[model samples]
Target: MSDATKLLAEKRTEFGKGAARKIRRAGNIPAVMYGHGTAPVHISLPGHDTFQALKHTNALLTIVIDGDEQLALAKDVQRDPIKPVIEHVDLVVVRKGEKVTVDVSVHLEGEAAPETLVTLDHNTLQLEALATNIPDNVVVSVEGLQAGTQILAGAVQLPEGSTLVTDPEALVVNVTQAISEEALEAELAEAEAEAGIEHEVAGEEAGEAAAGEAAAEGEPAEGASESSES
Candidate 1:
């Protein structure tokens, strides 16, 4: 996986929100690289290049800082939820043989048995793998599986040299018979009623507390007035 992604880098000369906005206006995204017991280094990367690279999850980066090259992984990326703009990215430096923990999405490859609904209980699995050799996604087959069947985390085969960091007994895929509409509605109503009852009880307790405080102050003033009259 030695596909080197080239990015035009620029040094961030200023700090704070104003500086970040200025960087974005110049078609660049502010990024900070930190890891391996080093102070965070702030920099700017070409907006288009950063966006394109991040489109691939677990993107490997060859960052050039002041003519020095470093291998990094995109640890975090902030983006506009509805737009194509990049905000800020957090990168972690990595060595060739270093192992890192990451989460990979679970992908179902085959269909379940007839009339059995395949439910994905876990969408992703945690894995500890070499930095440069991370798997894109974990694929699991449910071909011809019947109802009441389950696939555990450990049962899903991982790529060679990759170790599972998630709990072995964690349920990944579950095949269950579909519930009827009546049962679903009944459960929903019961949950809502339980929540409403709890809220009402809390409100009553708060009201009682306020009333008690008011009564205490009123009694103190009444006692003072009676003593003055006497």
Candidate 2:
């Protein structure tokens, strides 16, 4: 929703893998513009600028599309599995006053009751809000909450003009009693025992392989020595 999310776009005439590769070589990102009952338009954007703008979740982009100014929201981004380079991006056209449904991160604030552990069941929740006024994040309080306490989706407060799209009864945060040191040690011991068993199995397999090789060599040498003596 910031002016920093503006994108300078260039219409892409070329298609296929070769064109996309060429675009990447030129330090640009291949992106698609769709949605709002419009045709999919292929475009290229500056790589570094696009990456910075996309740091925001559900970022509202002021795009210069085909010499016309249009507002859009980042719908999806495809990135390389092993590399940090982005592969493609999907943008959805939107109006300033339009209410769009998006997921916003829920951050925990304050500490729970002593000796209790706070577990977040949902990190983000879906909500409908204005395109130009999307909330950055929602904060949930865990102040002095005891074990077995759960916060539902509907119980969280929303920013102005925002409505929850997720199920109201869905659990968002759960506070539970912390595990004892003995329990943790017991779990670790079990894991170590399992690993030791696997190590022993591998050692036995290696020993068997060595024995087979030694027998194979001895048999050949014995036959050769007998023939030479005769």
Candidate 3:
């Protein structure tokens, strides 16, 4: 985990949407701090500082409220749908030695064996780690892995003091033989034939429309000529 980011916040006495809007208009975001079996605290945090602090996943924060410091982690953040602004935040109170479950991203490193395709079955892993020691990401190596090779969640090496909360037998990375272009095309054609489906061709539709117009014009001209002769 990264070092705790320090932020100064003010206790908010106002409630409701109007009050929250007013708080945001003043360049602060409304937040709620809860957990550890205490009453929830409503506060306002600086917009810029809070935004920067939350850039890190499972960021440990040291919130200074009324000169008293409390350690917390950013559990949830609400943002504007079309704007780059944070509307609200939820902070969960934590202690120094407490264990917390968090999802860590799985990063792939190295290359797989030649002529093989590598697929990631799981992109994140649930892990339990100390509140102040959460890992940024877990690395998985596919170095020279051949076809039919699979890496399970249990086979991954994690940071010290971290325990996997995900199922051990879950597949993480899989290596498979690459399919040739000819085989792929043939498979697609076979699927289309089995489905008994046909796609409309734009050029064919245009030609049929032109032919119908010509036949209609010819009938109209013959009728006019016959009426003139009569």
- Per-residue CA lDDT of candidate 2, range 1-230, in tens? 45537788999999899999999999999999988898999999889988888877988888897678888988999988998788899988998789999999999999999989998999999999998889999999999999999999999998878999999999999999998999998998899898884434586676677667767887542223344665
Clashing pairs in 2: none
Model 1 Cα shift for residue 162 (angstroms) = 0.6
Report the lDDT tens digits of candidate 3 across residue range 1-230.
Answer: 77899999999998999999999999999999999999999999999999998888889999999999999998899989999999999999999999999999999999999989999999999999999999999999999999999999999999898999999999999999999899999999899989997777697676667667767887542223344665
Off by over 4 Å in 2: 183-230
Pairs with backbone N, CA or C atoms under 3 Å apart (clashes), candidate 1: none
Output candidate 3 Cα RMSD. 6.4
lDDT of 1 by residue, 30-141 (tens): 9999999998999999988889888887878989988888889999889989988989999999998899998989999888877778989999999999988888889999
lDDT of each: 0.87, 0.88, 0.92
**Model number with the top TM-score:** 3
Ranking by TM-score: 3, 2, 1
